[model samples]
Target: MKDSENAVDIKLIFQFFMCCLVAIVFLSSTYLEFSDYAQFQHKLKNKNWVQKTMEITPQMEIEIFHYRNHQSKIIFKENQQEIFSKSCNGQLELICKYIENHEIQIISLNFYTFLDKNTNNYNEFLLNTIAFKDKQGQLQTFPYMTDAPNSPQYIAEIKTEFRSFFIFAFLKHLIFAIMFLGFNLSFNVFKKSTIKLINNLIITTFSLSFISFVIRYFLL
Candidate 1:
């Protein structure tokens, strides 16, 4: 009876350990995806504000560069020397300003793609509307989009751009964690097995973990 109880305890302990391992692995990966998605959303929300600020600035030229990884660099040039550069999803906030006739011309601007971590996809930076505040502190917006903002084409484009990110971030992780826990518990059950049961559990756990990781990598 004592031996049987000890065996059961060992099995439960091992199961708990494997469960913890899976949680840690998935948690870390999910965190990265969450971080990227958050930054992506933040940039999108601020896109309009940035464009307006840029439009309000005086005597400035802007150039955008796209990278293979789907990131973009926006450079602001004044006199071709006081160059201000910022990247999409970067830690630094977009702050554009210039002193003209002793008045601070605080402005913002830029367009850039956002990468979706799960699907390895991204959105194209489209030139939308430009906005700026007038001398009376009233905001004015000008059309800059190729298509009308209310047009079906423009609405469709925005909708499809970030469709997969939220689903993958919330749904996929939950499914994977549930599946991992189920498999880990099943693999740890060793009723009537020989002394090699522990070794079998170890090998099976490691193999499953590795396979899961590979699948996730390819999915990304």
Candidate 2:
């Protein structure tokens, strides 16, 4: 009877350690996702044009031409490879009008792409906006200058709710966690006769989190 009680205690201790490991992985993955999303948001708010541009297209170079008539043009190139060009009069005519009226001072031009990390896809990153110095000399961003129908509508609006961002990130990671467990369970990958259900779950969670970490570290 004493041996039986000792065995139970040992099992409980092992289970506790396993649970801790799983929790660490889950929290780490969520934090990584949240951090990346936060960094992206920070760039948007601060108008970190050069850093943001390098993230989307590391090889590309950006050039801006300010005309005497208060019009502007932005060009993207890659070592003689002309990638994209945008004139203020085209999609950015409203911005030109603002400049002409001296409502704002053009500080720099920037491009943005809405990246969906979960799906590993992104929308077109384009030079369709300008960062400006307002009357108070504060840097402000004017997003979605492009009139193209395919451009993301959300780009035109300002985002301030980071809580929603975190919630989305959490749900995304949860989905990945569930999928990982389902795949492993379907294959009976943890079918060891001695392993209990809780242990199996803990192991699966750790595996999923590790895989997620590796992918995010290398890709994002």
Candidate 3:
């Protein structure tokens, strides 16, 4: 009877470990998804704000480059540059002054064709918007478009665009620890007759954990 009891306890402990592993994977993957979604929303918000600031025309392409220190550059299409170059600078100055006054950090900006205003091919153009975050966690935006003379292309680096989710990282470990303890306590209630069921559960949990880890770290 003593030996049998010891064996049962050992099996229960192992099963608890398996459950803990599954919970860790589930929580970690959830945190990663949340983090990515937060960043995606942040950028989307900035993009929308920039769209509202400009008069878009179909025949023009625009690009705006900005940095954290309130410095910015605008590239316009050749023909449009002659018309809008001075105004673009003045616009940039106002944007920079506002950012500097409010203590905001300009992370990065993306340029793309927002609207093709002109039905005819001649008036079709691309609109550019700049996105930045202020000290109060508010997004600020501005708009510009490209013309003939200034056809400079600004490629924002993908790696630098995302903000780190340090808080999520820390919470991941804390949740894992709590799950480990919870699983251990829950497994203590199982009977020896349910060992087969527990074993199957362990296998399923492990498989799920492995799949989650692969999807989060490799596939994503």
Q: What is the per-residue lDDT of model 1 for residues 1-220, given as tens digits with 9 covering 90 to 100?
A: 9798788778777876876787677667865764574454445454332221234356776555567997666576886754455553432213122122222223444443445557766444544533445556665553445654334575555546545654555454555555554554554344535325554665565456445644553343
- State the C-alpha lDDT per candidate: 0.51, 0.57, 0.49
Clashing residue pairs, backbone N/CA/C < 3 A, model 2: none
Cα-based TM-score, every candidate = 0.31, 0.31, 0.28
Model 3 whole-model lDDT (C-alpha atoms): 0.49
Q: Is candidate 1 or candidate 3 better by TM-score?
A: 1
Cα lDDT tens digits for candidate 3, 98-181 = 544656555444444223234522221224656767678887765544421122222122222322433454455455555554
Location of the lowest summed lDDT over 10 successive residues in candidate 2: 47-56
Clashes of 2: 0
* Candidate 1: C-alpha lDDT: 0.51
Global lDDT of model 2: 0.57
Q: How close is candidate 2 to the true structure, as a TM-score?
A: 0.31
Instruction: Point out where model 1 deviates above 4 Å.
Output: 1-72, 77-144, 148-152, 166-171, 174-184, 187-220
List candidate 2 segments past 4 Å from native: 48-220
